[model samples]
Target: MKKQFFYIVLMGLVAPLASCNDFLDMEPMSEITPEDYYQTVDQVEEFTNQLYADILTTHGSYSSTFEIDKDTDNQPSTETPGNKYDNTGQWKVSMDNSSWSWTNIRNVNYGIEVITENYENGTITGDETSLKQYLGELHFLRAYAYFSMLQKWGDLPILTQAFNDDEATLVEASKRSPRNEVARFILKDLDLAAKYMTPDFETSHTRISQDCAYLMKSRVALFEGSWLTNFKDTPFVPNGNGWPGTAKDYNKDYQFPAGGIDQEAQFFFQEAVKSAELVAEKYKNSLTRNTGITPQSVSDVNDYFYMFGDDDMSTYPDVLLWREYNKGLGITNHLEVIVQGGYDVTRSMVDCFLMEDGRPVYNSSIPYDDQTIAKARSNRDPRLVAFMKQPGQINYFINEDYPADHARKDEAFPPLDVGDGTVNRSLTGYRIRKGGSFDKARCDQWNSYTGSIVFRATEALLNYIEAEYMLTRNIQAGHILEYWKLIREAAGFTGAAADPQTTNTYTSIDKEKADWGAYTAGKLLTDVTLYNIRRERRCELMAEGLRWMDLIRWRALDQMCKTPYHVEGFRLWDVMQNEYDLEPADYDGGNDAFVTPPSRGQYIIAYENIQEKSNLYRDGLHWMMAHYLEPLPIKQFLLTSSDHADVELSPLYQNPYWPLVADSPAEQ
Candidate 1:
């Protein structure tokens, strides 16, 4: 995997900027210069393959982002931070570095440039169909790089035809494009890509196929449409042009578009559904649930969850795309399950699952917000049990003897002996199982090889259902209920369908199959659909680090920024009184001569270290516009052309919400 990433970067073909002095250039010691590389089909194919490798080179999966997105009200960090408050140890913070982004963009654009040049010159010729297919793949990658930039920085400079010295000269003066325009450009590229891409799943687990393109289109469309419609307070334009430079006060008031939420949202959602359906038509796949598996056929539903346990593609065909991990490549052993001593899913998200009856767990008659956790979770969606672990649930698989003594394996336990007790050690008792391999013994490293799940069949189904729900309120008519049934069956649940409806919308359920209540009643598909997708996304792409982007796009960061899970118990002990019949020390309020109580097992120890809950959820405040878009760096802003300078720059550089650098003096 590392070599694959390195080869892509090293193999990139970028002609150096025009030389100034001939003697200074010398016979440049270069490895297969760009001039000789783009003259053949094989060369182009190799170059594109290397470019795909760049995706693996940049930051390891979404692990960094997940720390900030999932470790708050939505969920808490399962692992206690060695240092609190200065919890920069989380996932996304590491991604804030400017260099990583530039390198990634450079690699992707370089690939695009080579492919485009060959295609234009007619220098590369292959089986016509195969050539077109490969071209589609190249376009898809370039689009993906731009999309990532858009997600992170909102609007970025559009560098479409690749950047050589001349393009660089122009780009150096180019400012940021509006997010709306950038999104439009991405969609255009994808539209062209879809036309040429091979409409099939890749035979190899890690290669991008045609379906991947559609999945990306669906994702980008939904993101833009949702943000434009739902985030009204942060309109794309103030007056006629984009973002007016009037308001200096972050607190004064921020407003986007009014219809960006209600009516306008429906249009984009409809488009999202169309793209999703296209992928499903081509892939012919769906997420398999527990209902189909017999108890005797497999050990449990968990067996299905660990489908990607081995990186050996020879054995596992379920994984669509991945980066291979080899032990010989200096791979070190470290648990890849991010939840163990890192961030975990939020509790609010736990409650976000729909009930067995198709109602939100919150809709239960009981006051879910109160302390009745067991009741709040009772009768909830069965997926919750499959995804999360609560106390008393027997989770075997720790130091059990393998091969000879597989049956005697002991359940792994979380570290609970922190100075502050086990309460803060790991907030969520449950650890994530997604992307974790059970066959670690075969690989030299424990589980260091990380492979990203770029696209899967399940997401296609989700996209289809989300679109269906938006177009028609009636789950039955919209076919939303059917998809829910498919998901439930795949997860091993079987029962009457859940069909719920809203009174205001006059939503109706077929009287014969009122069982489909869950979908009929689900409104704004934003939360329900978001929740459904989030769970599968989390479970499917655990260590690959995809969950963090979803959190940002949905503006769920505030909800996931604080510690969300804490263990609570009654205070039951003081210091010890005596030791081995030694004389007692002088009594003091802060005396060291104290002891814990004998009934320690029964006594409760309150853990204030619960996951910090988010105050930014609901009311759409999570979707606020400040971090919605990233600002160009101060240097770029200054050099931008006058036309772009007229457009508003991000306030972040001027007055950052989060400090860009740590104070050196404070550290001392």
Candidate 2:
């Protein structure tokens, strides 16, 4: 996978998509140099346009962003288990950096170079406004590329310009920057991007704007601040115990830019608050209303329910960045699941949503029951429950677009035929209702036209709340109270109920043991205010592909090393079994005896139910200190070396607790 990622980056081939010109026609890089080809702004814009189409992760299948929460407590899937949580430590060192590929980086660097050089040299003949906007896009794209890898690999090579393949130049440039420096570099790029961008671009919302840049900037700041604060004295951080970066000559005598780690972390917290406030303040009134409408209710369709499936999100003010799919251009998305159970979310996600009255379900007086799926969602947060399928619910909430032949995956007691493909589905009883529509065009394979959101403005709100609390250790400080209130109210709370303090008062840290977010660095978080802040984020961004990042940044699952966690779902052995007409028995090729017995637990265990005792996580999910950061690819080390695969000579360093040998797993 690493080699594949490297190849894509090395080749820098942009697959033609639906565009104004022929996307298939290759850019004649050999014939067109900056002196000749980049004379017009449109020419430069065309090159940058490919970044938008190629970089963003548009919908590819039923399990695109929805499946990102798989290993996290928020969501689990039947489509095999994740190596991170299976306790076998199968996350071995790769031959190449698939996840760490710099394909987009190289492209962005090239665009920035030619455009800036041409504009400064008077070679480009266009308005400064358009040229600056396109340059802003390149900068934003570069920052985005770096931020994505920063989460996976804490330390990264900060590549500002495209480099030649000369051995000395390449090896010298491979020196890994400290994680904090990489984060700072990303923020600087975003700063330039925002300075060059407009608040409202003439182009549609599909393009990145100043608001989007600020939101992403806030996200990166909050992430780094949280990580540095949580892993203060750990090997994963620079200058900390057993830090691998300190082993290399360039990083061995590193000095914190802010004097110390604590000061540096505070700097990020301030940056997070500063950038987030810019976006949140502007878009606070723009949060889409939650109409509290379910499929079972007799209300006109809720706009919030259709936000993810809508073909156009340009009008939605709070949606910072989104991708529009056009069927006419042969650029379509395929997320149709013929069966309702393709992407199953975990029950913990349901529990994460607070009761509309601002209280956790464990302590709420709202007469809630956990035995059935319906009872669990009753009177809870509307936005969270809206995407969770309930019994007797229609497969398509609004089916004006689907045709007669369009197959429906309507809920019929959470279909649990766990052997074949679609016939055996819905691993957990909880089904994901995100990106679902009755549109026949969308239901067709590779023919959907729904817009895919790359960045939502709500992230700014989430980042501000967490950053403020982390910095001051008080939600009352700064605009944390105001920002948090907006989020709570948007989720359907009102008056005193909308106040975050109310939830903080009623919250019990012990009761939140099931939630991985409740812990940081292997111990329960003592402050209730911060826990509630985290709870809001977990609820708001359930399956939007940010859960894993949150979990590791907080060091949430560090306790798993001693006390492993079982991946559980709906209560199949309880009265729900009778409601769903399921029999609790041992597995026999997934016939009638597919479910795990009552001895395992009343709720469904995703891994424990497997046959022949072949379950990888039968011992439950566990973690190690080394698991926080991925080991560097062996090929990266080899390329950085003066001669042969001499890892010692290489300026790049492997992550702490990870092995230097190829294909080897973590030492911990």
Candidate 3:
């Protein structure tokens, strides 16, 4: 089979620059310049295609991609040194210089500038449709780059135009725009993109289409709106206590586009609702179903599992954007292998899934003590059985001959033994089975040609529900019940439809008791409606690199540091230890050195015995308010001060709570 158009883009961008000294140099006959480039629709499209390779394909390693979900309540990495945010004193102001970089923004802006100038100057002729579509893609890509920056560093220097290498021009572009203004700019770009973009791209789901723009607009708006709502009174948001943004003398009394902060939030939430509703309505019937799914057999096509792992996603209309891979071309990834080995789905994440009967897993009918691997796997949400690896379950379908010592191949419930021969074994007993393929031949291949779903309509559904509820606190609005039913139905839950009036017999109260981080921080999900919506999101999108962002926007990291919350694994200490023939000697250190035996029937607290050395919840995970918005690099401030000596201090302001020192400030 021929490789997909996705690889063509990679080759188109890389082949041209492989031998060039400077991509922008004007002199050489061999080198391409802006004048030579953008002369044709093909060149312009290829230029925009590079954005996908740079931004999206950078996450080709499934292990590293999923690692974003680890060290949080939802998941944990088997190899533990703990994440920077987990320690009380590890996260420092100078640790992240890349967040200060604007290379991607500059590239995107340059592309836009070249295209707009060329089109207006009549230097290039094109089918107007193709030219406008390429322009829309650039705008969307620029907005995407800015959205990424906004997430990491709250306020940013909104650089719409590309600057030359001159220092004065660089310094002029360095003044930080207010966070709210940055969000509005992103929305404006998306609106322009939607106006010029086609509804769908012809080359599968890899390219930016009209729906992709709407979905992203919803995602960006919801993130900003929720951040403002949850943290309105805190310093992390603009115009709040200790907020670092300033309206320079020229724009000191700046008013939000929607009057004030509260109104501004409502404005974005409404935008989120508008955009999300459009996509959700357009793709309401796009959910992929396992038509031939059975208790013992799973079809290799047309199912949720295949949608995530298969090389072709054209059949799944719900997937608005996807990255295709080709093994023959040497463009492949081991996402399936990583799913089988590298990470563990936390017990808290598993518990987040509601039972098949639409009840919490912790309901009195299904108490926590009854949660053995076998018991927990039975009658739970079909997703639990479908997406998670249980003890003694076959991981892959192809019956391949292999060394007996292969860590995961044909292994039944690969023990959570870190020292096991396989590098892919889980630290927590629960392994991720979501994207593992049944085809064993492709499992361990270096360039595994499994496609990656970049965006799906499912997210738009969830976004609409959240934005609508947050804006009006009404679950009945915009077919909330209808969309939720679709999610449940897609997950293989066949029951009487969910009723908003009927309270679930099981409450998150018990589950929250085990995961103290659930109730702490500023997370105030007291209402059943909101709690259920949040629960649905967590369960549906687990291990998808979104949990950390959700937690940050919700301001849910504070409680994690209040006390050392135990990051518990499966009830392996109670059940699997004996069942798997595991011994104390199998651990990192023998008996007294490794794990401390839990009281019978209790869950395994990871690294409980050697907490100090393991970095696993030893000091507890903490989040400083300043961490809400990453600090601009101290070097940037120093450069500004030295370059513009006439100005006594740099015009830039540091995010609140971050000291100018290289080390962390005293504990909050």
Q: Which candidate has the highest TM-score of all?
A: 2
Candidate 1 residues 1-668, lDDT tens each?
11111111111212242344421122121244456665666665666676675654222433332344343334444433212223232222221236225555555555566656777777766665666766777777778877777776664556653333232344342434545557767877788777876655356655566667777788887776655543444433221123432333441243333333454456567767888777665544335443222111124545344543434443333344555555578433333434223234433345445555544443443233313233434555555544443333333343223332112122233332243442234333333334444332432224445444445566666667655654674556554656555655555555542332321122222211111111211122323443443444443344444444554455443221332322222122222111123222311111232211233332221222221232111111111123434333333322232333422432322211322232211110
Q: Would you give me the overall lDDT of model 1?
A: 0.43
Q: Candidate order by lDDT, highest to lowest? A: 2, 3, 1
Candidates 1 and 3 compared: the better one by TM-score is: 3
Q: In lDDT terms, how accurate is model 3?
A: 0.67
Per-residue C-alpha lDDT of model 2 across residues 307-356, encoded as one tens digit per residue? 77678887777887877778899877665543234467776777778887
The alpha-carbon deviation from the true structure for residue 532 of candidate 1, after best TM-score superposition, in angstroms, is 7.6
Task: Please list the C-alpha lDDT of all candidates, in the order they appear.
Answer: 0.43, 0.75, 0.67
| lDDT: worst 10-residue window of model 3 | 3-12
RMSD in Å for all candidates? 10.0, 4.8, 6.0
- List clash counts for every candidate, in order: 58, 4, 1
591 in model 1: Cα distance from truth in Å? 18
TM-score for predicted model 3 compared with the true structure = 0.88
Q: After superposition, how far is residue 100 of candidate 2 from its true place, in Å?
A: 3.2
